[model samples]
Target: MDWSTTIATQVAQIPRSGIRAFFDLVTGRSDIISLGVGEPDFVTPWNIREAAIYSLERGHTTYTSNYGLESLRRKIVTYVENFFGVSYNPLNEVLVTVGVSEAIDLALRALLNPGDEVLYHEPCYVSYAPSVSMAYGVAVPIATKKSDLFALDPAALEAAITPRTKVLMLNFPTNPTGAVAPVETLEAIARLCIKHDLVVLSDEIYSELRYDDVRHTSIASLPGMRERTLLLHGFSKAFAMTGFRLGYACGPEPLVSAMMKVHQYSMLCAPITSQEAAIEALENGTPAMLEMRESYRMRRNYLVKRLNDMGLDCHLPGGAFYVFPDVSRFSLSSKEFAERLLMEAKVAAVPGDAFGASGEGFLRCCYATAFELIREACDAMERFVDKLQKEAR
Candidate 1:
């Protein structure tokens, strides 16, 4: 009768996502101004939604190929090459999965043996280490510091490499910190990966949301990287299609084929309607994406400035929708700071430790909320911070 005995060991050992766990306290609370979840505030563009509706009207409701609809695959590859400057054959080198989450699982499961190690930067998305663990791989973290703008350190990555290391997982324009990898740093990491012969899982879902004219250079696009890198992207972020849950993986034929094998037996295929909608998103969703990007840029500017003015020590993140501000000065743990902020200010921002231990002294404030709401949250936060400082005094 003990559920603990029946649960898989790996699943039992893996803790629930810290981000979701913290947000659970805010559930059903309509009064909170939330900067917790990373989803875009904008609705999916009407044309893209219309595409899904049109596809449904045409009765395109059946299961697609295990590799996904050929049209969608072609569109995915074209988008990747055009935007990321990394080309792949659409026929055998692209696999449309349920989302970037599924693609991460597929790649890790396909490549990892028991105890194989995955080297990833910390203060990253909550899913990276858990996905590696679920695949029976050892999750090795390379700590990225605020001084480095949270970019993955190539030297740190080199030190983490061992005989057991098999994959390097990267999420640039990263989660929590909004750190974008520099091209030179990426080139150095790419060199190390080449020397070590490690497969790179480049998760560039936030690649399109970059700010301040910060260019996103994919590790996959660097010399000697395309053959060994799996590029993961989707419509969830830029196109505001989170509910559709559509994403794809692009890489060498053999790697994509291997991921497809696992995906076929598991997910089978991404939803047909989502795939059709994704096709539209890739083909004609640019102007809307740009507008949303600009809005986020404005929000990011306002939020970061407010945090710094309130003495939170936040660096201007170059990409993504989140700002990680150092809260060590408040003399409270990240969790305590965030919990008090929610309860007292009715403002919800994620504790940075929700991402990883390296995030212990910080809080992640998402800028994807409406600008007006973000302004209100800032006002509340300023008052909350002033109260905390007075208590210390």
Candidate 2:
């Protein structure tokens, strides 16, 4: 019997993740050096890992409050305030989530009515558009160009707004493109959100990975935005706690309460052990994070120089470990370029189109791996480009 009709239409309609296909292609291949996945190569810092182990040793395995451990929540409050200058009430304004992924879905679920429109930048995280669709909302894409360093344009945002637009989903130090929105740009977008009376779901998982003396600016910290923004952050990128599956959302009491209703039923709470680890991450993980950020900065500098030297037209990423380089000179679609590079050079990078249609002529190379491996991948890529140029002749 065909199961397609029996499943929820939206679930059935959801497209498979574009990144998965590259993983499938290279799976179990020892020769391939992958720059595909966005995950950090570092293990969770020893202190944070030790804290979780100690928590288990103390027999603290039971679930904490549905809102997550009060202690953890309080630490989150302090972390955001001290780091971003944003204040949140731990008791009612913070809800722990399985990850920023879940926080995105929860915010959408809580705020969107059927047919409500959610506007987000394109060439964005692969999950953004699908998450909106999963919530039964209309997904609107705002195209950001490389000319602008992929920053969200206020005029483009204003043009996308309609009476039905309910939310503005933002990711910075953005994935794939690695662009950080400047304070002035974010301020303009915040004003547009305020003018349109839209909710802002700011995904800041990569906030700590910025480089070049640039600090991350959270839109939620702007005047009048605190009440309208649901800020999402996680331990995955900065703390190398991807396996821990922990994140949190902070916002006004009512919005946090609404997201909590969905979270309490769906996730119950983030894992107790992970919550314990996260407390340690917030309290004692800054030095480790700074070290990791510095490593990424070096890798970024090396990779961008190599790509530009090869005539790939890569911009210096302001934040995050990934670089989106324009590969149109190779006269190949993004997918074809990625496939050929994987097959020929055994260096794996994500096809930029995996991110969105606007990503068609580019490719995303993640520099979160070891410095040596990144250098090797660059060498391999240079050889690949040279071969293509020779072939053109």
Candidate 3:
């Protein structure tokens, strides 16, 4: 049986996620100290977990509305407005999905026609380009530079826009690089989006994980952008609810309705237990979330300092839990560095290129693991890096 001919061309061409592919090497290893996967080290707060349990006790295990539980949707709106300063009509504008991944797919399918271009920064989350391609849209990547703290340049964004461009996707406190756009830069990009009449997909999954008091500003909150942006967020990162797999999208009624149409037939709705838990998370999960955020901040500081002290040349990331350290001096490709580190040092970190081509000479180390494990990973990396530098000399 020739499976290649049977599968859709788009599905056949897309590569498996670079992050997952790298982890496959570590699957049987118990000795590895991993700073690879981006997920909270903390368990979900007990109170939030209890909510799910309580809901199940009450026999609330049935399906929710395709738009999700009305109570949860309202809570989502309130949380967004309070935290991100973005307003939405929960009744019509919010559609809950399985995860932010689903929201990304739904928004792209809702807004894109075949051949439409979606602009996003490079060295971004591995899924962005794949999602666009899966939705039959062209993924246009604008390279962001390490010299500029990896902030997205408005000029580059403007240059990437063409008549076929339909959407601008953004993830700040971004994956791999942990780049957060300054308010001024966001304003500039918002202006360009307005000028080009493009819709924006703002993924704020890591909004609560920022460090050093950095505030996350949603592009949807800017003037003229509220109507043109789809805000994607979920409980996975901040609330440590990755296994729950709940996310929601809030946007204009027409767009949300369109996404809901596809979602209704496909995903149906996020799990009822997860929706019940999410409501509790939005209402009273802040204290526990903040406690977890503080732990991540301490780990970030220690890991970043260790990387730089080992001569890896990492900049302090303003948000997110990952650091992209320069490994070019080792004279190895990102994959080679990552592989050698995993095999020789028993420390697992992702090759930067797993994110995008712009990440070629760097390595992404996530600090979302236990502090002791992080310390161990850093120690191993320092030894590994020292050997590479000595070998180069």
Candidate 4:
């Protein structure tokens, strides 16, 4: 039963995702209404799918260049500059990745040395902490507060820094909590990073999915930030293209160069079909994306109103499809509450604690499903909360 000692200790140290526990319990149960995944419920747009089919029909089955196809990389540049107000040289600065997941892994793998430190906020996406650890980096989490609209405090961020700090990760339009950072907060954080000479890894995959007229401002777009920021985005949530497995990173030539080495060995290229699909997602998918985003906004409005009506303290998310309701009034552990509701009411939500300790008193519900489904989930929660209240009395 002995294994290699390198994997023995390291693998044991990797934290099990709190979100995965629900699937472990409910797998093969046909009745679970899962709001746990942070993806749009819509299928990939037909036009994008057709592009993938076209690529396959053209016999593009083999691996592309280690940095990915040149045409796709150029499309990525035009898309970023046009949509995100951030520009990078397509030839030197962009590397297509297999989902933002692989872009993140590639960056961490290439940059971190053993015992280096990286910082990010919590109630974060499930990947950042363990992924950094996997790269032999130590993670330092700064607690973001709901009171501040889940804003990352610049003071806390500065305090978390050390001589060992190698990079900082930022994820806004965030997961579990649908919190987006305003430009001012990003500017302040950028100031500290510049002063301390830190690299920033900014994950902005949900930028296009915001509610209101709230435009997403990339830290990468701010003064002097383009050089230090490793910007990660993809076509998943924006274009309803999660299955396409295409993402890209934009950064300084040197960082992109270093990451391409890890990417070459690990992923080679994002599938050629997906790259073609992604290019279409960039070019022709804008109208579909706008429609999808507005649908998510309607669902958000509905769920937030219903949760508030039931006396749950839920807010309309600024971006992304999730609603993180403060469930402390029920006086239940987030895990216990989520499981009991899934078993009793057949509505599956992620426990906020799935993200981190600050997430302990909340439940994350993705409102990306059909309005009927969101209605059903809200109805189920109301009945369940009433029963809990009766029992408490």
**TM-scores of the models, in the given order?**
0.99, 0.99, 0.99, 0.98
| Candidate 4 lDDT over residue span 1-393, tens digit each | 455564656558887888786668877887777777777889998999999899899998988888888998999999889877898899989999999999999999989999999999999998899898889999898998878778799999999999999899998899878899988889999999999999999999998988899878999999989999999999888888887878899999999999999888777778888888888888889899999988998989999999889888987779988999999887799988998999889998988898989898899998888889888888998999889989899
- How good is model 2 by TM-score? 0.99
In candidate 4, which residue pairs get closer than 3 Å at backbone N, Cα or C atoms, i.e. clash? none
* Stretches of candidate 3 exceeding 4 Å from the true structure: none
Instruction: Report model 3's TM-score to 2 decimal places.
Output: 0.99
Question: What is the alpha-carbon lDDT of model 3 when measured against the actual structure?
Answer: 0.92
lDDT of 1 at 358: 94
TM-score of 4: 0.98
On residues 364-387, what C-alpha lDDT tens digit does candidate 3 reach at each position?
999989999988888888899889
Candidate 4: regions farther than 4 A off: 3-6
How far does residue 292 in candidate 2 sit from its true spot (Å)?
A: 0.8
lDDT of 1 by residue, 1-393 (tens): 899899999999999999899999999999999999999999999999999999999999999999999998888878888899988888999999898999999999999999999999999899999999999999998999999999988889999999999999999889989999989999999999999999999999999999878989999999999999999998899999999998889999988889988988888888999999998998999999999999999999999999999999999999999999999997899999999999999999999888889999999999999999999999999999999999999
